[model samples]
Target: MSLRIDVAGLRPERVSVAPSPLAELGMALHALAEPGHHPGLQGWVTAVTAGLDPHLADRMCEADFLWRTTFSDLFLPCAGIPGRTALPGATLADELDLLDKLTDEQFVDCALEFICAPGYDLPSAGVVSDPELRRRAFDLAATRGPRQVRFTRRLLDDPPRVRAWLRQFLRDCDEAFFADVWARVRPPLAADARLKTDLLRRKGLAETLTSVSSAVTLDEEAARITVDKLVVGRSATGDGGLLLVPTSLGWPHLMVLHRYGWQPVLHYPVGSPEPAAPPSVEQLALRMTALSHPVRMRICRMLARSAYTTTELAQVHGVSAPEISRHLTLLKKAGLVTTRRRGRYLLHQLDVAVVARLGSDFLEGILR
Candidate 1:
């Protein structure tokens, strides 16, 4: 499945790179929820969680439904439809203020659209109107886990209370840790935005979009940006335009908020991060050696497009399954490829992050 965003009529004014405090806060909460997933933020996560009020910590646990998903629509101001002009100077307080503008019904409706649904689609959007549909939404949420159900119940049962609680929770989080972190991260985020905007001007939109993530590609002929995602959908940029938000906490993951009737917001992780210890010479050699082979290079390129099993790779490459497996083993050893079991098939995909940092690692290692 893929998301195809039509940008045939998109212009420089319509494409923007901005930093979002609400988006960062949502990511921070997700880091707190699943600290193990973000090894780079381990120290910060531990410190922040330890400093959080016990009640606030407990609230975050209950609000797992809010931050756990890629679609943290609650954090997106103006349904993510407001264009570039409105987003440049947006602060956390500015975003939070917009929340007060939502009427009780509008708030409940929006929550149901995002929270109740099993997936993002037209059918899921109407889950708010029908009792039977709402029950299905609850059943789907329950299937995800208990936390999803708990969070959904709070929103469904009493939206007004949930709204106030959510606002206060964010404020408490700002007071505890996020405010300081936001201040520290904003400069780089803005710098990244400026750099990307400049790139957009020089390279044109297609090349710029392709540069964002391995999962994203632009077909200049079709004038569409295709995103390799678990969900399949299509959207046009329209007048609302596209918002390219740069995030610090949302690393190693790209998020797209392309709901129908709203501006498509693509939240991509900024390229720069807090400096860390360089890789060892041994580690660098392993990665370089893995990519040195002609067959392995081809495999890496194929895996970049989509995940493939050994047999599938063999068929595509006109090689034996064992031969493909041997190549994959070397790539895995170098941490260049990762495998996930889907039913009986072990699907292998390129580790885009590791590959992306290869040049920088080589340069830094050589200079050192």
Candidate 2:
């Protein structure tokens, strides 16, 4: 549904982090199920998905028109999600059926009669006048244009089709992806929720909201939190407030949607993984060890001035080339340095951005 986004000024106490409900999980899973539908996703699908049915993937992708005009983001509830920290008891079928009913009655007018603002007015928002609804319709129609309005109207007229299509789409995904991948996804997703809760307790709301993901950031003057998404439309926040859901399938990105006719919710990948986790733990140790030695720090400083070769550095330090080589290896593993081979010499240069961000971004100061 035009990748709906609702804007709000959320107070510290009002903001919360939650694990996605089963229904919401279905939506995120749908986003990734069809790699063939979007060429860009093929590599991602191949890398992460095991034993995926090629035909099913294509079918799921086609169901959303390959995310061409409108998508199933409308099906998931933006407000009143049942679970606080784990998946809701609702089965996939239960979720699909509930959405079908909502779209049948609650969203019918907004889809057909209302065209401009195209705002999804939740029944929970209470009754609104026809004139205001019409105004919103016109606003939305103007933003999305006629083609999308027509497409959405057609779907509203036939809610069963969308429901059936989604039911099958999720079933196929469950077999190939979700059934296997969901367990691994659970802990990380919960950890992310806990991390935000802790951040809210420790750093307060403003900082936690800003650090939620790269895609979400706060506007200073208005206290408006803008979440970046594929589509562009401005939506007012509902009484239900903002919902922050940590996503497992949606890694390295963010999603903003108006819950069809509910509150605005932001689904984003979890940020700042726990240091105790497997590879991350080892990686952290490497970075700490690399930054600890004085000789390496001097080498980093020198490289920042200009790229240098091992022999040149060894000559300056009055050490053997092998020792400089060893130090450079450690720095590279720490992500503090990068190298480009120029004939016989491997030119080493400091990763200035990495080093600079170490003070804030990579938890280096926290590690200390």
- The clash numbers for all candidates, in the given order, read 0, 12
> What TM-score would every model get versus the actual structure?
0.69, 0.51
Error of 2 at 289 (Å): 40
Off by over 4 Å in 1: 81-89, 102-115, 144-147, 272-368
User: How good is model 1 by TM-score?
Assistant: 0.69
Q: Give the number of the best model, judged by TM-score.
A: 1
Candidate 2 C-alpha error for residue 123, in Å: 12
Tell me how far candidate 1 lies from the true structure as C-alpha RMSD in angstroms: 10.8
Residues 295-320 of candidate 2 have per-residue lDDT tens digits of 99889889999999999999988889
Deviation from native of the Cα of residue 78 in model 1, angstroms: 3.2
Quote the positional error of residue 340 for candidate 2 in Å: 24
